[model samples]
Target: MDVKETAAYLNVSVSWLYKNAVQSGLVIYRFGTGVNSKIRFNFSEVEAWVKQQRVMGG
Candidate 1:
């Protein structure tokens, strides 16, 4: 999904998602640097990460 879609799905701002989720490695994906470059995220991975964070009281 696009950044907007991801942000809406997570109920967070786009900037917040980029800073917190992307920068913090809470979600895993690739950053493109060329014409074919794109951002991608796995919903399952994100969900699992969130659950782990909650369990760890983060």
Candidate 2:
């Protein structure tokens, strides 16, 4: 998914994703270089990462 779509999927702001996605462990796919580039996320990988963050209820 693109930045907007990925942000929507995570219920986060686009700027937050740009600032934190990599440092927080999510992967990003970039196509081309420079200001006019496209980025995407592997939907399943993102889902897996989120799942790994799950905590059991008390």
Candidate 3:
């Protein structure tokens, strides 16, 4: 899904998703280039990562 869609689905701000998820390499994907660059995420991946984070007390 798109960045906005992912952020909405995760109930988080777009900026938060970009910073914490994308930049941190926690739960995001990048495609295209420059202004065309897109951000997407897999819901399952996000869920699993969250679960791992919880297990790790992060």
lDDT of all predictions = 0.71, 0.92, 0.75
Q: Could you tell me the lDDT of residue 32 within candidate 3?
A: 83
Weakest ten-residue segment in model 2 by summed lDDT: 45-54
Q: What is the Å distance of residue 2 in model 3 from its true position?
A: 1.6
Which residue pairs in model 1 clash with each other?
Answer: none
Give residue 13's error in model 3 in angstroms. Answer: 0.2
Q: Pick the candidate with the highest TM-score.
A: 2
For 1-58, candidate 3 gives per-residue lDDT tens digits of 7878877877889888877885555655778889988878887887776667555435
TM-score of each: 0.62, 0.90, 0.68
What's the C-alpha lDDT at position 50 in model 1? 61
lDDT ranking of the models: 2, 3, 1
lDDT of 2 by residue, 3-50 (tens): 998899999999999999999899999999999889899999889988
Instruction: Identify the superior model by TM-score, candidate 2 or candidate 3.
Output: 2
User: How many residue pairs clash in model 3?
Assistant: 0
Q: Model 1: runs farther than 4 Å from truth?
A: 34-36, 55-58
- What's the best-to-worst order under TM-score? 2, 3, 1
